[model samples]
Structures are given as structure tokens and as C-alpha cells.
Target chain A: MTRVVARVIVTPKPVVNDPQGITVKQGLATLGFREVEDVRVGKYIEVSMEAESMHEARERVDAMCRQLLANHIIEDFHFEVDQVLHRDTHR
Target chain B: MTRVVARVIVTPKPVVNDPQGITVKQGLATLGFREVEDVRVGKYIEVSMEAESMHEARERVDAMCRQLLANHIIEDFHFEVDQVLHRDTHR
Candidate 1:
């Protein structure tokens, strides 16, 4: 089994009120930033795992999110899984 | 000026207790995931901005963080600024 990295982002739905996100966006606008938009705030999860394939890695991460990483009633989560390349050090 | 993307991740220092991260890590282990470790929880900020240079873009984002994106007393933040690639369509 090889190491895999999963980056999970959890955010509120568009219809849901994101007070934290809004607060951050408003703050940005105050700092002379005019072009910022859709400033949604979310969580990032970095997990190193050993999985045989990308599909399996994703499945494992999906289960992790549903069970604990995110509060399903009010939030949604998405993740990207990739294999970790270990560099060989023999020259 | 070109568009820039900033991905900011804010997390508590390692010495600080991270209940959310610990909970997720434990949950993963329970589901037969043994290789996961140091699962830190953070935030991702995707900002589309027009900046003249990387230094200027970073300066703007740093100001944003100090003003709002992260709480200075409880959390520390790090960000990556990259020029956004916009594909022009002409046939």
C-alpha cells in the first residue's frame, strides 16, 4: 500500500447563511480590496493514508467526512485524493 | 493587473489542543484507516484579485488576515498566492 493525501473542504451551502464567511469578506472589502467575490469560508482536512487505489482512497475519505469530518445537517464537504510520491534517495 | 488566487490555511499551533482534528483522526482510525496522522484542520480562502506583482498580492492578503480572515490570538495563518490562468476563447 502506498501513501495517499486527501484534502477535504467543507463549506455551507449557498442558501445557508455563512456568518463567518461573510465576516471575512466584509473585512477584505474594508482593506481596499474591491474585486473579491463569493468569499465562502471553509475547512481543510489533510490526511495521509495508505490505500491501494485512488477509488479506495476516496471511498475511505468519503466515509470519514460523513461520519465525523463534517456536520451533515448544515454543511457539505468535497475532497481530492492523490497518491504521495516518495523520492528514492539512492544515487 | 492580473487575477490572483490565495489559498490560506489557518490552524492552531501544535501545542494547542485541536478537538476537531483529533475527533476526525480518531474516526478515521475506527474505520480501518491506520496510516492517518497529524490531521490538522484549517481554512481555505479562494480570492480572485488583480495585483501588479506577487509581493503586492501577498501584502494585500496579509492585511486581510490581520483585519479579519483569522484570529491573531488563537490561530496562525499561511497563504499561497498564484496567478490565475484565464483562457481566452477566440475562434
Candidate 2:
């Protein structure tokens, strides 16, 4: 089996209100970072899996993201799948 | 002024206990994703800023991450800074 690592990023839809992002933007302003604008907060998920190939790994990770990693109603998810070397395997 | 977008990813240190990750891993197992392993949860933050140059923008975002976006004690943060096109500006 091939060991693969998937980095998934889940972000709120543009129309959705991101209270956390707003709070952070305000915090930045308070810190004298007035130049900062349009801050968006999201979730980053890393999944390591054993698959037959990179294609299979990507498909499985995509399914995982859609099923649990992200709420499709308000969030959009994207991911990158890469084969892991023996030295890079966490387990 | 240059419009730049910074994507920051924050993950817990390897030594830190991530309850969220453990929970997710359990969920995956229950869902019959036995091939999955070492699931980690983290935060992804995107910040758009106006600066004089790309170098300045990167420095500012790095400061922002260090000051408020990430807790250095238990987390490690990395970011990618890129120039934003006119059409990509959120505001």
C-alpha cells in the first residue's frame, strides 16, 4: 500500500458571515495593523492514509472532506494529496 | 501600494495533545476508514493587506501570526504570501 498525506482546507463561502474573521481583523487593527483587510478564517485538516495509488488517496480524502471535514452548506473544501516517503510517515 | 494575500496555516506542535484530532480519527475509524491514520486538525487563516512591497507584506503578516494568529508555545505556523490581482481584492 502507498502511504499518502492529504492537506485539506475548508473555508466559508463568500456570502457566509465569518465572525471569527471579523474578530481577528478588529484585533489586527487594534494592534496597529490598519493595512490588513479582508481576513478570513478557515480549518486545515491533514489526513494520512494508506491507498493503492495517489488517485485512490485523493478520492478517499475528498469523500472524507465532504462527509465530515466540511459543512457543504456554508463551507467549501479543497485538498492536495501527496505520496509519503518512509521517513515522512507518522506511523 | 501592492495588494497582497497571505495564507497562514497553524498546526499543533508534534508534542501537543490534539483532542480534536483524536476525535476525528475515531470518527473515521467508526466510518470504516481503517486505512486512515494520524489525522490532525489545525487552523487556516487568510489575510489580505495593502503594502509598499511584497517583502513588507510578508513581514507584516508574519508579525500578525506571531502576535495573535498563533500560539507559539504549542503551535507552529507557516504562511505563503502572494500578490493579489485587482479582481481578487475582497475590498
Candidate 3:
């Protein structure tokens, strides 16, 4: 079996409000980083698994995101099939 | 002034425990994605603002990461200075 690693990123839809991002921006301002104009927070998921081929891996990951990883109503989701390599260890 | 947009990604150090990731993996398994071997969760931040120049933008962003965006003790952070463009609106 090939080791397939992928990344799924979830972010709030532009039309939706992000309290966390606003809070973080406020925090940055308190820390004296007033130059920062805007900030939006998101989730980055790294997945490692076995797959028959890259095609299958991409298909499965897309399904996983739709079924479980992201909330389609309020959030936007995207992913990349990064690698089908051996013994990768970068965290 | 140049408007520089940057992205900072912060993930737990490999040695650190990620309870959220573990929970998400369990959730995925419950949803029938048993082949997923491991999952690590991280933060993705999109920042938009003005900067004097590209070089200064990168430097300031690096400092911002070290200062407030990431907890360096338990998290590993990296970023890319994506664009120094004008009137960008993609979130």
C-alpha cells in the first residue's frame, strides 16, 4: 500500500462573521501590532493514510471533507493531495 | 504603501499531544473512514494589510508569528508571503 498524505483546510465563508479572527486581531493590537489590517482564522488538517492510488486518495479525501471534516453551510472547504511518498515525517 | 497579504500556519510540534486531532480522527473513523492512519490539526491565518515593501512585510510577519500568532513552546509555525497586490478580496 502507498502512503498518501493530504491536507484539508476549512475556513469560514467570507459572508460569515469570524469571532476568533476578530479576537486574535484584537490580541495582536494589544500586543502592539496595530499595523495588521485584518485576520481570518482557519483549520488545517493533515491526514496520512494508505491508498491504492492518488486518484482514489483524492476521491476519498473529498468525501471525507464533505461527510465529516467541514460544515458546508457556514464554512468553505478545500484540500490538496500532497504526496504519495515513503516514510514521510515532516509534522 | 503596498498591501501585503500573508498566511501563517501553526501546527503542534510532533512531540506535543493534539487532543483535537485525536478526536477528529475518532470522528472520521465513526464516519467510516477507517483507513486514515493519522490526523494532525493546525491553524491557518490569512492576514491582509499594508506594508512599506515586500521585504519588510516578510520580516514583520515573522516577528508577528513569534510574538502572538503562535505559541512557539508547543507549536511549530511557518508562513508564506503570498502577494503584494492591490485591492484583493479573496478570503
Candidate 4:
């Protein structure tokens, strides 16, 4: 089995009200970050899994994102999966 | 001034205890996702800014990440800045 690492990014849909983002924007303004604008906050998830192939890893991670990592009603998710080389094997 | 978008990723230090991640892992297991392991949760932030140059944007975004976007005491942050071209200019 190949060890795979998946990085998933989940963001609120454009129309969704992002109070957290707004709060952060206000905080930035208070901190004198005048150039900053349109700040949005989201979630980043990293998961490791064992799979038979890259294709399998990708499919599994995608399913995981859709089913558990993100809320389909208000969020969108994107992910990338990469194989990990075991240290013992690399030596 | 040039419009630039900055994408910042902030992740917890390896030594930090990630209760959120652990809870997610347990939830996945309950859902029969046995292959999932080593899950970590973090923050992803998108910031748009107006700057004189790419170099200036990068520097400003870096400072924002250091001062406001991330908690440096327990998290590490990385960011990328890219220029945004006006739609009218492209036409």
C-alpha cells in the first residue's frame, strides 16, 4: 500500500455571511493594516491514508471531503493528494 | 496601485495537541472511514490588498500574517501573493 497525504481546503461560498472573516477584517483595520481588504477565513485539513494507488487515494480523499470535511450547503472544498516516501525506503 | 490576492495557510505546531483534529478523526472512524489517519485541522485565509508592487504586497502580507493572520505562538504560516488583472483591461 502507498501512503498518501491529502491537503483539503474548505471555504465559505461567496454568498455566505462570514462573520469570522468580517471580525478578522475589523481586527486587521484596528492593527493598522490599511491595505488589507476583502479578507475571508476558511479551514485547511491534512489527512494521511493508505491506498493502493494515486487514483484510489484521490477518490477516497474526495469522498471524505464531500462526506465529512465540508458542509455542502455553505462551503466548497478542494484537495490534492500526494504519495509519501517512507524514510526507510528512501535510504 | 496594483491589486493583489494573498492566500495564507496557518497550521499548528507538531507539538501542539489538536483536539479538533482528534474529534474529526473519531467522527471519521464512526463513519467507517478506517483508512483515514493523522488528521490535522488549520486555518486558510484569503486577503486582497492594493499595493505599489508585488514586492510591497508580499512584504505587507507577510507582516499581516505575522501580526494578525496567525498565532505565531502555536502555529506556522505560509502565504503566496498574486496580482489580479482588471477584467476591463483584459478585454
Candidate 5:
């Protein structure tokens, strides 16, 4: 099996209300950061999985995101999958 | 001024408690994501700053993290600073 890394970014769609993100942006502005713009808050999850191939890993990671990591009603998730060397199989 | 980007990853120190991360890990396991391990949850803040230089940008980003983005009592933050092409100066 090959070790794969999936980096998932879960964010509320643009149309959706994100008070948390808005609040953060406002806070930045209050802190004298006027040049800052387009602040959107999201979840970043990095999952390392052992799968036979990239396709299988992507499918499994997608399932994991749908079932656990993200709420489809308010959030959308995007991921990038990469193969990594298995430095420590014993751990 | 130059436009710079800072990617900050904030996570609880290893010795600190992370109940939320632990709960999420358990949830993933319950969903049959058996390969998942060592789940650490944190905030990823991407800041776009217009500063006189890279050193100034880093200082401002560091201050932002200390004042608002991170709770130093429980979390540690690491950031990567980059320069991005400004395609829309008007916007």
C-alpha cells in the first residue's frame, strides 16, 4: 500500500452567511489592517491514509469528508491528494 | 507598498489538551476511516497585506496572530510568507 496525503479545505459557500469570517475581517480592520480584504475562514484538514492507489485514496477521502469532515448544507470542501513516502510504517 | 500573503497554521501544542480534535478523530473512526490517525485541528488564516517590505509584513502578521488570531496559552502558530501577483489593483 502507498501512503497518500489529502489536504482538505472546507469553507462556507460565498452565498452562505459566514458571521465568523465577517467578524474576523472586521476585527482585522479594527486592528489597523485596512489593506486586508476578502477574508474567509475555513477548516483545513490534512489526512494521511494508506491506500493501494491514488484513485482509491481520493474516493475514500471524499467519503470521509462527506460523512464526517464537512457539513454539505453550509459548507463546500476541496482537496488535493499527494503521494508521500512511508518513512515509518511501524508507527 | 508590496502585496504579500501569509499562511498561518495554529494548533494546540502537543502537551496541551485538544478535546475537539480527539472527538473528531473518534468520529472519523466511527465512520470506518480506520487509516486516519493523529488528527490535530486548528485555524488556517490567510492574510493579504500591503507593506513596505517583507520584514514589515512579517511583523504585522505576527502582531495580528498574537493579538487576535491565536491564543498563546493553548496554541502555537507557524506562518509562511509569500508575495502574490496583484492582478486587480483597483479591486
Candidate 6:
């Protein structure tokens, strides 16, 4: 099996309301970053697993996103799957 | 002024413990994603701002990361700065 690492980025859909973004924007302004016009916050997840091939790895990661990693109603998700050498439980 | 968007990704240091990731890994396992070996969670932040140049934008965002976006003691961060067009308060 090929060791694969998938990096997933989950972002709120454009139509969703994100008060966290607003709070961060205000915080930046208070920190003297007045040039900042907007801010959006999202989640980044990295998963390492063993798969048969790159294609299978990507497919499995996509399924993981749909099933649990992302909330489809309010979030849009994407990921990059790559082959990694060795198997280390701690990263 | 140039309209710039800086995408910041903050990940926990390799040495730091990530219980959230562990919980997610267990959750995935319970969901029959038994091939998964490990998981890690982080933050994805998008910041849109005005700057004189790409270099300036990157520098400013780096400062923002150092100041508020990330905790250097336990996290590591990197960002990509790009030129964007127009201005929409929501997106």
C-alpha cells in the first residue's frame, strides 16, 4: 500500500454568515491593521493513510470530507492528496 | 494601492499534542475509515487588504500572523499573498 497524506481545506460558503470573520477583522483593525478589508476563517485538516494508489487515496479523502470533515450545507471543501515515504504515527 | 488577498495556514508544531486530531481520527475509524493512520487539524484564514505592492502585502500579513493570527509557541504559519480585483464586503 502507498502511504498518502491528504491536506483538506474547508471554507464557509459565500452565502453563509460568518461572525468569526467579522470579529477577526475588528481585531486586526484594533491591532492597527486598518488596511485589512475583509477576513474569512476556515478549517485545515491533514490526514495520513495507506491506500492502493493515488487515485484511490483522493477518492477516499473526498468521501471522508463529504461524510464528516465538511458540512455541505454551509461549507465548501477541497483537498490535495500526495504520496509520502515511511509511516510515522507522530507528525 | 493594490488589492491583495493573503491566505494564512496555521498548523500546530510537530512537537505539540493535538487531541482534536486524535478525536477526529477515532471518529473516522468508527465511521469505517479504518485505513486512516493519523490526522491533524489547523486553521485557514483569508485576509484581504490594500497594499502598495505584493512584497508589502506579504510582509504585512506576516506581521499579522506573528501578532494575532497564530501562537508561535505552539503553531507554525505561512501565507500566500496574491493580487485581487474589485472590492466586495461579503464573499
The numbered model that scores best in TM-score is 2
Better of 4 and 6 by lDDT: 6
- The numbered model that scores best in lDDT is 6
Q: Any runs in candidate 3 off by more than 4 Å, and if so which?
A: none
Write one digit per residue (lDDT tens) for candidate 2, span A14-36.
99999999999999999999998
Per-residue accuracy of model 5 over A1-91 as CA lDDT, tens digit each = 8887787878787678877777987998998878776566777776766888999989998998899999998888888888877556321
Candidate 4, residues B55-80: lDDT per residue as tens digits? 99998888888888888999989989
lDDT of 5: 0.78
On DockQ, the leading prediction is 6
Give the lowest summed-lDDT range of ten residues in model 6 chain A. A82-91
Q: How does chain A of every candidate compare to the true chain A by TM-score?
A: 0.84, 0.94, 0.91, 0.92, 0.89, 0.93
Tell me how far the alpha carbon of residue A11 in candidate 4 is from the true structure, in angstroms, after superposition: 0.2
List lDDT for all candidates, in order.
0.76, 0.90, 0.87, 0.86, 0.78, 0.92
Residue-wise lDDT of candidate 6 within A1-91, one digit each (tens)? Answer: 9998999999999888889899999999999999998899999999989999999999899999999999999999989998887565444
Question: Candidate 4, A16: how far from true, in Å?
Answer: 0.6
- Candidate 1 vs 6: which has more DockQ: 6
Sort all candidates by DockQ, best to worst.
6, 2, 3, 4, 5, 1
Give residue A59's lDDT in candidate 2 (0 to 100).
83
Alpha carbon lDDT at A83, candidate 4: 85
TM-score of 1: 0.67
- Put down candidate 1 lDDT per residue, A9-36, tens digits, no spaces: 8877657788877777777787767767
DockQ of each: 0.45, 0.87, 0.87, 0.82, 0.48, 0.89
Taken in order, the candidates have interface RMSDs of 2.5, 0.6, 0.8, 0.8, 2.1, 0.5
Q: How far is candidate 1 from the true structure (C-alpha RMSD, Å)?
A: 5.4
Report how far residue A63 has shifted in candidate 3, in Å. 0.8
